[model samples]
Target: MPKAGRRRSAVWACFTENTASGKRRVLCLFCHHDLVANPIRMVRHIVRQCPNADEHHKKICREYQALTVPARRRPVVGGQATEAAKSADALELESARVHSDASAPPTE
Candidate 1:
């Protein structure tokens, strides 16, 4: 299907299912090239030409590398943690609350 709005010009892509995550993502096959052309042809062009298209790919690679630092994580500027960490922390809080309530004395 044709993409809508601004992204309408962006390329359409289907990510192969990740074996570990079992999730898929859509992406632009071409580097910095929008999906303005015919969908099937666009997909083909992206596969064949996007990797070496221009400086945009280089920038994307640099950004991706920066985001994947293992030694240190980015500071939570607004207290927003990654989704996985947030879910685990929520579970811990829930368990603590349950235990506290369960162990407390009964009241009239």
Candidate 2:
């Protein structure tokens, strides 16, 4: 079947069973973390694993980070370009709702 979106992290696969409301769950083949039915969150979880994650999980994370060519989703403000910085800035803006929030984005 044709893919809906770009290929996700190599460490995880989506299983489409056991859904009360007919929703699939993305399972991490590495560290088993239960993320909601959101692909972006799944990717974030894989990329930003806990500090004490197992060596295997860390190795997979590093490999994926090196392999994937990240696109510039948000405009670069300062020289430092990192997800942590973006999330921090996002948190600072009380007016800005999270991506996970179902509400529509604030109109400019």
Highest-lDDT candidate: 2
Q: Candidate 2 has what TM-score? A: 0.36
Off by over 4 Å in 1: 1-34, 37-86
Candidate 1 backbone collisions, by pair: 9-35, 10-35, 11-35
Per-residue lDDT of candidate 1, residues 41-69 (tens digit): 44445445566544554454444444443
Question: For model 2, what is the alpha-carbon lDDT of residue 60?
Answer: 65
| Runs with alpha carbons beyond 4 Å of true place in candidate 2 | 1-9, 13-21, 27-32, 36-43, 69-108
Candidate 2: which pairs clash? none
Taken over the whole model, the C-alpha lDDT of each candidate is 0.48, 0.55
Top TM-score: which candidate number? 2
lDDT per residue as tens, model 2, 1-108: 797997655455422223554566644554444556564555456667544356665566566656564655765557855554467666666445554355866678
Error of 1 at 36 (Å): 3.4
lDDT of 1 at 10: 29
Cα-lDDT of candidate 2? 0.55
